[model samples]
Target: MKYTFYLKKTLSFFLFIPFLFFSCKKECKLSPAECHVYENSGSDCTKTKEKNAPVVASLKEIIHPISGSDPTLNMEELSAIGDYIGSAYFVGLGEATHGTREFFQMKDRLFRYLVQNHGFKVMGFEATWGGALYVNQYVLQGIGTAKKTVRKMKFWTWETEEVIALVEWMRAYNLAHPDEEPLQFYGFDMQSVDEEYFWIKDYLSDLDLDLFNSIDTLLKPYVSVADYQTYPSLSETRKNKFKADLVKAKKLFENKESNLVALSSQQEYDLIHQAFVIFIQNEDILDPKFGKGRDFYMARNSEWIRNYVQPRTKVALWAHNGHVTKGDFWAEGAELYEAHAGNYKVIGFSFSKGSFQAYQPKGVGLTTNNVVEEMDCQTVNALMADVGEDNYYIIFDELESTSAAYKYFHKKNPFFMLGSVFYPDSQNTFISLVNLPEHYDILIYFKESHFAKPY
Candidate 1:
């Protein structure tokens, strides 16, 4: 699968930096010591309500870096996160940007800790259900190559060495503990235009030829993204065709028709139907009135995985900050928080400044990575350095909304927001309004970071 480029259409300008460099730009050999966080109050940003709010004391103790990447080395710090997680069956690892190496590394390290220490039996990704199936097979059953299956997920930002390491490690863990239930991967993103067609083919692959053709014909318009790009007017046509086909798919998959082989599980059937739901509404997604329907479906799909699909009662979720943050913007994750009623805990990753990667699609068949240097600190991401650690976790649960710390964290600061696609030299790289305790239960802050190099 190719790197899907649908979500990078907008960006905030206040976070933009003057440097317009790409991946090959002069690499800085800056010292690790020099990278420690600093505050520049003069910069344009959301002034913290308690810029002087007494730095949290019980929470302010300096955090030490792990002796190495071995998550076991930092048991105390890792378990501290578990403290905030409480008894919630689900834990979310939300990243501020898609391509940060530290975010990826810490996520793998953190999840491993949870699985080993906390019994998080399954792990879910922010990928399409169809995209994640193959990787799940490879990791658990050893059915195919890990990297290639991950590539099939289509989100190039995550097709990295870091993820490959995480998958391989999970495989080893599963192999060592055959008697125990194995760790699994689950994808819950709203389907992009491509998977909607591919899933139809796969679902009907076991059907007789005539039946397959009849259904495929109705889905012909949205099969290739190039058609949409070349002929922008095809959106309405795509919507109509998908809606027509969706009716057929719903009828076929809903009833317990014993003869249905290719479309077996209600989960798989739901994925195909869900894809069409998002596909037909693509044109209206940008309209404020209609946009949230997309995110609403995202949360529903994920909650479906949690409530029905996975046998595991507990799970760990991985996704960019945009999808998982409790912000009012994305309805999918927000719906999850609403439905679970505090039964879920979200831990969002934040960064001050660093370069990260994105995909630039070269028409229909190809795409390339561009590591754009993140703009300067203007958000809560910047102020994190004051807590006095290279990396640390802040538990927001203790701060009530009426408290100075709470109001300060709620101010609209510009946090670094890059995902599957980004542009260097764009006016600003920030797309988030930093409301800390409200958006995430715990904030994992990385003062400085670098990009991930995918294998």
Candidate 2:
């Protein structure tokens, strides 16, 4: 039931994940790794500067205050961020809430700064690898409109004007740098594979119609019934058969790899091969015996990009804070950090308070509400809110070991976190205890959050 629930909730639709069963704030009993808090340690840090005066003062000394999140504005302040990244090969840019307009805009601004100043080449999203290939087509070749390309991503969280602006910016940058190395966009997730199937079918049909017929016949039965309950709910025997058929299809593709690559571009062959990989990922997600979650597979996909697909190329990944944190506990970025070690970095985002868009209970639509959770100084959100500026960025590695900010960040802090959905009035759902310094190497704090405008 745990596996089926996750499959139906994430793969079928509404794929915003890590749907943890949170404990009550009044008597929280969840483990420190899961709830991200130290038991009975809420008073470990000081609420006023009297007991922790050095911490606040240290934060002010090393913090770089930014003017605003507007990407079109002067970016001289953001140029300092590149110095912190140094030679890191992979950088994770995380959002506190998926529906924040300011966060989205700020990422756009930060990404532009990285591309223009640094030698970063690839931009990966927490989206489907197969669908993102189509988006890559539009950005590199002008094959489709920005709105249509983003919609192909199949996530309501990304169907926003803010995202579209970023996509168009990528295209514009590529066009302007015709002679230089153009930036490449990719998706590192494998949950949604509609676009994967389309590309695989198109490739097979064009080259080998008879082989295409056999594979399509096997896949046809499930196409019409691929709904929330119908697909992931398949019986054990049927699921095994489905996986066997996909394995056979992959073998068929592998046998013809040489001929396919000779006839078409290497890019085309790579697309179909990756599609088969995604099909296997889809099957594994449904099989409890696979013993892995989406985060593990997402980490593998991103690593594949850096190690296999584009070796030596630096990548900037965009995803939620939960997926991007590198804490000792569980997270996609944590997996990557373990594999890459000093070559990777995670930058976390945060907000004090304001209205932001979120999904309601059913599949109705998005709602905007102000979250008024009472946050004491023990939390990073409250501490950042007390800063002198409305916006600022901090690098944990830059702090002195004896600085108060270093000690404060090393302790447990209940950071405010939100996915794509939440109850209408449940502000407690947004609270999560996290060790800031361990989870993220850099931090960007916004004084207030604003709802992301949907396209």
Candidate 3:
């Protein structure tokens, strides 16, 4: 019962996200106090713009235009930036906000380009490993429908029409390119272990009662691996025991012990076993001794994709800007960068002003509101807005030589951050000091943004 605008392309996968669940409400306006990140009067960092004026003026010249929603609109522009993708095992398409439509569209388009043009064969997400197994089967093979596979996921952000269209496109591309490398979907998160948990049970239900009982015995101690919700705090000793048991249980089928099982099926079971341990390890957040946090596990999962899961050397990663950027501030990205040496390249996202989906003190969808307030005069968003471009991409390498881009290179400064929450406490949401060019190899900016359509 809602009217949303949409367009269909030739062999295209673009679709407008439906906004059926919410009604328009009062326009959420912002005050001067909400814009500034600090108590200092110098929150208006516009004065520093004089030194960066030359780079600002050339913004339109250097940036690749990403106007409109069809990410494939301009092939020449997307191709021109291939050098930025470089010779890396991983090419990351990071978003500024998980709740922005443009972010999803452009990242999808970019990854699609990689699958079609580059030798990149794997498309990984920051989604649950268990959920992605179902999605992976559907996208690579024809096991299930696009909508159904995505709907089965625990994460709400990805359960949208846009994602469905992307998966469908991947399916068609896979069918068409049988001789060439097929497109595969993989998740590199410790989100949940239920799909793997249940799949193991059902898979062994027919063949080996001993294995089923073994898996059951391994799982009986825990309540629910699927929910991962509010479980009792586990001691390191208990965590280690579960980790060892899951590994031993998975090897029962793998390691050539069960020659009757398919290699693919065995591989899946083995991966699930390892991923389950990762899920348990990540539950601890960060390690007390080594400082190995969730990001470390995330980075390790990326390595697993290349080494164990996928045979391809080149892959496309989709996640938030924070997880992809290589720096000490973010453990996952830092670990990925360090693991790859100079082989890894990340593209980061930012927005000028527009409504985006985010949470408040508690639960609520994007709701109808212009939460995408104007940028702080002193921040990076304000600087890019001064460039007067609708949408574009700039190579950080080109700007690294300039003395004027010094502030961004040397020190941390205010940057746009619209996480899942951006209202009431919009002032307290995703405002972190970051060295943009340092954090990302390439930067994509939009003059305005719209909220991501929720399922």
Top candidate (lDDT): 2
Best by TM-score: 2
2 or 3, greater by TM-score? 2
In what order do the candidates fall by TM-score, top score first? 2, 3, 1
Stretches off by above 4 angstroms in model 1 are 1-53, 56-72, 193-203, 207-210, 225-232, 235-238, 261-292, 359-378, 400-407, 421-432
Residue 40's lDDT in candidate 3: 26
Query: lDDT-based ranking, best first?
Result: 2, 3, 1
What RMSD, rounded to one decimal, does every model reach?
A: 8.7, 8.8, 6.9
**lDDT winner between candidates 2 and 3:** 2
Off by over 4 Å in 2: 1-53, 222-228, 289-291, 307-309, 362-364, 373-377
lDDT of 1 by residue, 267-293 (tens): 444544555554444433423343456
- On residues 13-56, what C-alpha lDDT tens digit does candidate 2 reach at each position? 11223222233364447543333222332464444546666677
lDDT for predicted candidate 3 compared with the true structure:
0.64
Rate residue 7 of model 3 by lDDT. Answer: 10
- Model 2 C-alpha RMSD to native: 8.8
